[model samples]
Target: MNRRDPRVVRRLSSLRRRRLAFVVRETAARVTRILLIALGVLILLAGAVLTPLPGHVGLPLLVLGLMVVLRNSFQARRRFIRWQKRHPKLIFPIRRLMRREPEILLVAWQQLLRSEKVVLRRPGWRVLKRGRKAVRKALGKTPLS
Candidate 1:
């Protein structure tokens, strides 16, 4: 195990090769990250352009782009967190979608109920709150927690 022992030491050439391989791996990783970030940005742009369409085609693309960007870029994650704190209600759905196990149906239902409340505002209809409570209960989460 002595460093001076010929049998225990690697050849200088092999050591150099190892360092070179490490450098290549690191460079490749950096390039891949940059490329992914760019791709994510392009997807986000496309989503924004398609958002006004009637079929709801762009929302998923936006979420996918956001996930990619957030996963690959530390700056994006930090900015997103800052914005989320400033506007929790606006960012709530996006945060939910970003979770490892996203509640897509629940978010959709909640948005639907919210739109109904906004458009109708019937005093007798407590469907939004009740829907939240029911979904939360089913998921073993406390309502409004």
Candidate 2:
């Protein structure tokens, strides 16, 4: 209980020490994220540079950079997911190839079937498509297709 006691000083300093530790942790996390993002960008640039050099490291470096960036970044992950959803036919095959699986063949076949265009008789098809676009334009709506 005496002011001169070491235990008293330690007890008084504990709250300030915890606050300092919390601030350090938060600052460290921000710095780590920045570093990771920078590292990922540098790696991607390296991969791009390697692409025309006739080596096998380019694609692997690219994937590694992508993984690191995505793992560290919520914004990048969201954007990537949106892009993937918009282009599954393109994304699916790449995903399969990355996994070293032959399932991409099946995915290609599925996409081929799904993409088979039908130009035949639907009397109002043009009217519907055009009308939808016109109405969407009038309403200022985003295009889904």
Candidate 3:
């Protein structure tokens, strides 16, 4: 545990060695950050263009773009946090997608079931009511509630 020990001295000497000048390191980091922001913007634009086309393609691209932008840009992160605070409900789905293990299928199924419930509220829609009941049960909810 001595500061002047031979082993400690070698570690400290290695720590002081610089592989690159400070300015080079800073410039490289800035360039990389700019490239990432540009790439994120491009992805976002692509997502917007593809959104109107069909299937479940564009949403993932949009989420991926948002994640890249948020990761690389401090301003974007600040704005996202502010928006998230102001509109938790609107931001919830994107936040879910940004998770390490996003439950895409489950989220889609839940949304589908919710929309079905909203659309088929009449008593005559017995088939969907049964489906709703099954979904509720599978999700650990009581059917009556």
Candidate 4:
């Protein structure tokens, strides 16, 4: 539906592909970090129980594990900031889109509801209610108090 120049379309598509790849890489890095941390803990426990292995080995493993965790945390934070900058929609596009196609409002709602950041058993209800209210206000509806 976007009748833009071919070059523009190509650029946009490439950017989207790159962003998706980055997200996948970020997720993989996080998984690797968790596994490394777990392995480090296990190594530490083994070092404690088994007197044969030098304490130095376990200390290095723990240090490496902490480094991996820190690296992943830093990368994730940077990626989040980059994503926010590159995809402003992730933060504020709902209001703009709601003005154009009110019917697609439910799509946005569904996205927020199904977000991984929303812990379903915890404060999810509160977040959902707040999201709904925000969306409703964006759509120019009289929001429920």
Candidate 5:
């Protein structure tokens, strides 16, 4: 017997829908990258047969594939940043909750490593600095062991 607020349920449903859409878009981007890479490979192969045309056409095709890959990479990164922004409070405690448990820590670390936002590093560094400041204020300069 789970008692849940209707409004909360609705909000969760909305969030889930948005997340699904993001996942679909991300998947599409990845598929596009693969298609572009395949296209570039085909173009380069065709250019090999065509000689001088390859230098002109193959180069641009390769560049186009590279650009598509980079664009998809950036979009994933932006989505990660947006997710982190939406879920800041979940970060620190989630870390702390896993600290003592090595298995959990390893799993969490792997997930974090996979995250585009976490790969950025600088934002995480800033978050850590802020956390340290807050801890110092709360505990009066107690050195973290």
Candidate 6:
């Protein structure tokens, strides 16, 4: 069935009809964007947790989260583009990995291996550990991402 009622459309003034439709559209878009951002964050956190698992679900989930956020968030999209520009070596492998082709994983691994610099992201974890210990001594939980 067609959702919009013809009688309702005919009854409203042209400008009022436009405004009502505009308001509904804006509200829907706002809700959708917020939901997408929340979902993206949840996916990203899950990915981080899954990263060290034996089967290795982390990268794909992380990339998926990134794509969701980039699609809904202008700032995130800009930042990701900037980051890609800054780390050209990392971008190709990530793009290949996100393609979801069976043989691409090996290609991505090779691309990563051929890169000159290995990026170790342990510093943040170390700092978080220190903070957690400090917060434990203070009898408070450290809410870190």
Candidate number with greatest TM-score: 1
State each model's CA lDDT, in order. Answer: 0.88, 0.74, 0.84, 0.60, 0.57, 0.75
| lDDT of each residue in 1-145, candidate 1, tens digit only | 6677786566765888999999999999999999999999999989998999988878888999999999999999999999999999889998898788999999997788778878777746767677667888999987565
Error of 5 at 127 (Å): 67
Clash pairs, model 3 backbone? none
Q: List the candidates' TM-scores in order.
A: 0.73, 0.58, 0.71, 0.35, 0.37, 0.62
Give lDDT tens digits, candidate 2, residues 7-79. 9899879978999999999999999998998899899889888867886688667766877788788998898
Clashing pairs in 2: none
Ranking by lDDT: 1, 3, 6, 2, 4, 5
lDDT of 6 by residue, 43-95 (tens): 99999999999886897798889778878999988887898899986676666
Could you tell me the TM-score of candidate 3? 0.71
Model 3 CA deviation exceeding 4 Å by range = 1-20, 113-130, 134-145
lDDT of 1: 0.88
- Which of the two candidates, 1 or 5, achieves a greater lDDT against the reference? 1
Tens digits of per-residue lDDT, candidate 5, 1-145, equal: 2339888888889999999999999999878877765665566465455546524364334334433443446664475457658896554433343234435545445455446355556765555446656879898886655
Model 5 Cα RMSD, 1 decimal: 21.9
- Note the residue pairs that clash in candidate 1: none
- The count of backbone overlaps in candidate 5 is 0
Q: How close is candidate 4 to the true structure, as a TM-score?
A: 0.35
Question: Alpha carbon lDDT of residue 38, candidate 2?
Answer: 86
What value does the lDDT take at residue 47 in candidate 5?
48
Q: Who wins the lDDT comparison?
A: 1
Query: For candidate 3, what's the RMSD?
Result: 7.4
Deviation of model 6 at 26, angstroms: 1.3
> Which residue window of length 10 is worst by lDDT in model 5?
93-102
Clashes of each: 0, 0, 0, 0, 0, 0
